[model samples]
Target: MRLAALLLCLALPVAAQSAAAPDDMARRAAAQLQQAAAGLERAGSARDRVAALTRTIRAYEAGLAAMREGLRRASARERTIRESFEVERLRLEQLIGALQSMHSSPEALLLLHPSGALGTARSGMVLSDVTPALHAEVEELRARLEELATLRALQDGAAQTLEEALRGVQEARTRLSQAISDRTELPRRVTEDPAQMRRLIESADTLEGFATSLASLPADPAAPDLPDFAAAKGDLELPVRGTVRRGFREPDAAGIRRPGLLVETAPGAVVTTPWPATIRYLGPLLDYGNVMILEPSGGYLLVFAGLDQVYGRAGDVLPAGSPIGLMPGADRAPAIPAAATEPGGQAPDETLYLELREGDAPVDPRQWFRLDED
Candidate 1:
């Protein structure tokens, strides 16, 4: 009787093993599911999705392994219990039969086992009593499931927001590139004709003055200051339409006999003041067919020559872009022959000469005017 009681005590653990595996498996599955859901929520882009999915799958696979191991251990223990209780086990046999019947039916497995059959002396210590550890693990798993579900929902919403932001950035970049292309091409198309080129030059000169004035003004006091010339230097547009017939030279040939700067433009083309300036001279000079000298508000002198007509007289405060003259006859050295000359000899071509002087010395106009990339 003593040996039988000892054997029955050992068999009790084996009988309990059946419930252990499934509980462990459920716990592991729950933990993995939670981890996967958290990863998904933090994902930001396509790459993020891949990373989250990889981690999630790994967790699930680990849980699956734990579950399989638990199930295997439980099955082995159940077999042992059945074999041990084979003889003089009428009561145990009936319990095993009931257990086996319940196992066979899916619905029965879901229900808790009855307490009295487990052989516990305390009515409180019943088959229905789950181990505290198992109960805690189950609760942990349930919490994780809820967290994962919430995380997954958040991840989905974030992914959509990221996709929309990416699309908007791409569209804006495309439009900006197109605008730059159009601005670059405009100079090329209009420069072919001398008359059109002159107009473009006048516009460019006026814009350069406006940009310079803006640059002279102090930057917004509240905004951070950028490096000098960062906002102002390149902001100015090209000041002439015709190709740079002659660039800034060390011993400037286009300068007055003294030394200054000069740019040859098409004759008869309107010469607009770059800045608000007063006309100082407007008449013929030694080599300049028609000369006009301006004293600009910014303490600079601008001299224009080779004009077919003059619109502003001396003492006139000319605004920027104000038409000053028409291009000269063809006999004059043509600044833009292709643009100024007609098919027949009906009209004469003209050229423009520019000189920028600071006090008495000449500076490089190229530094101020925007040059076409050749």
Candidate 2:
């Protein structure tokens, strides 16, 4: 009996060790998962930014291409103008040659007075009538010459415009394609009915009012778990680097207060998320163009709108600074110098509207985004 009892005691320790092994492994696995989640968030943010820049760069390049095409059309018109002027020049030259031939050699035969006083009087009358006609011919020739000079200048201007468009194309294309390695991989956390969400979005009247309804929606459990949203506070980078055109809650021309921020950026300026979050909705809303909403935390939703084009859809897990979309430039805005565009390109006259909501209550984005005074 003692021998059997001793064996049982030994087996118990072995069993306990076996039981602890799985628990220890599970704890380690959980830790690794958290760490991987954080890493994914950062990588996603970087990729998102690249995507945004790519979108904007493409828009700028498209504009340059259109301008070049317009320039080509203008050049064709200038060529037509030059051809017409050439014909006018030849006609004027022929007239001058004929006039010179008639007047180049003057004979003293008339002054000889074969018939005396009557012949001299008739010659004087003939000279007076011919004088006015010569004056008219000279004036017509001078006007035709001036028209040719104007046409030449017009052609020169068109050439200059074309050359400028050509120069912009290479630079814009280079910046967009430089990062060939970076590609976006937006993970689908959960299957969402985009049509359903968009319908819900349309039903709401105001941004603040709509976001309140969105706050109640359940989060995707399968979403890659990332770090805390508040951890990025104060140190949060602006989604897109540009000049702040309007402050949050600032009154406009009619004295109506704006609840969000207006950032003026180059056409095709890349916009990224400021925190790890999931995209809840992406589509147009009222006067706001293409809109995207990111839920950074349980109750907070970040709103970005006035985009020329949008990226990703609902249920996408995005890391901080991930590219979501682009700020629009004027569809036909003139090209500004390189100085006008940052490492990016020239900003369009348009503005990106940014609003933050905590369960439907509007919060000043100025508090969230770092901005310059005034």
Candidate 3:
């Protein structure tokens, strides 16, 4: 019983050393989760519940992402340990047999050697050296087994946490939609003329044409002044949590190319405004899904295509990090099991098409947004 307790005590440190990265990630994710929950509670009385809920939703996303990564790493480590054990199975068996024979042998027989006194003395010295090494191997094997058990426990616990995060994010999204509907606080940059907008939408045959026509519309003289959008180059955050699947002007599977980024995102993921901008247009256009056109400054248009739902109204001036829309897809399930099946949890649920234009001419968005390398 004492030996068993000692093995378990030693196993903890060994497990921590082996799985340090994953364990650290899990701890960070847990902290994020707590932050999200706290944000949700505080949003009930917050002056800007929309912004608070936005932060909550983002926290949930970040937490879920980190948790998924940790689980993936843990699963990989577990597989590696199992594989190592399989490769050393024969050697382990021999070691165990040797230990068992030493333990069960009669003391008199152990001392008695077939050879003379000199041979017996030499054998005793050899046994003294070999016994400690054999014991060390046994302890290591026990440690590995304990680590494997710890990993399994961690994975099991992660399922509940993932589920909680998913539900929390969904609740935050629903509340954000409600808050947006209830909101009448944001100032309009321009009072949109229905007839003029209809005429422009009907006449434009291409995105460039549409953008040029939209630019021709008069700006509100009383609109609030904002910081220069040009000065924000290389410092802008992406509107959503996603990976850039296609770079600017990069060809797609059909060999067609566009002067924009194609970002892959999870289903129902929240999309935000990367910077303060006036909504020039919102709704469906051409082959694109639901779209949003933003004007951060004169002669500049930031276009986001392929949203499932859009919030706010045309001409509404929104602040940076404002919830704009969501990517189309069903809610994610508790992803612990999925992490094992699909490590990294990066399966794309939808694609967001982003375009930037200056004077209706295309420019690479990568020059502006701070995209991390995959």
For candidate 3, the C-alpha RMSD (Å) to the true structure equals 5.1
The estimated TM-scores of all candidates read 0.31, 0.50, 0.88
lDDT of each prediction vs. the true structure?
0.42, 0.57, 0.79
Q: Candidate 3: where is the Cα deviation over 4 Å?
A: 1-20, 203-209, 330-334, 342-348
Better lDDT candidate (1, 2): 2
Candidate 1 at 105: error in angstroms? 92
- Candidate 3: tens digits of C-alpha lDDT, residues 1-374: 22233333333322233635676788788789988988888987899999999988888878888887788888888887887777766555556666676689875566556688886787677666655655676688888898788887878788888787777888888999999999998978765689988988899887767877887777788887766999999998889998898999999999988889999877787899888898889998887889899988877889999998999998899999998998887364445545454545444358899999888588999999999832
- Tens-place lDDT per residue, model 1, 1-374, is 32233234334432222344434453564465455445444433334332233333334334333433433443344444445445426544544454455457665333434464343333224324533433443354355445435433433333333233223323322332333233221111101234632443344333234223322333223322223322333343333334455555544455524233344443323345555555655665545566666655333556676665565444455444444444454234222122112222222323466666654445566665666621
- Model 3 error, position 75 (Å): 1.1
Worst 10 residues of 1 by lDDT: 183-192
The Cα error of candidate 1 at residue 295, in Å, is: 1.6
Candidate 3: Cα lDDT at 92: 58
| Candidate 2 residue lDDT tens string, 1-374 | 22223223222311011112222332343344333334333433464545544444434343443433333333344444455546555444545554565466465643335578887677556545555655665664465445445434543444444344434433433333443234347666774567857766778897666666777777677677767766656666667656687788888788878788888765556677878888888888777788888888777888888887666667778767666775665344454333222333332346788888876588777666667621
Ten contiguous residues with the weakest lDDT in model 3: 1-10
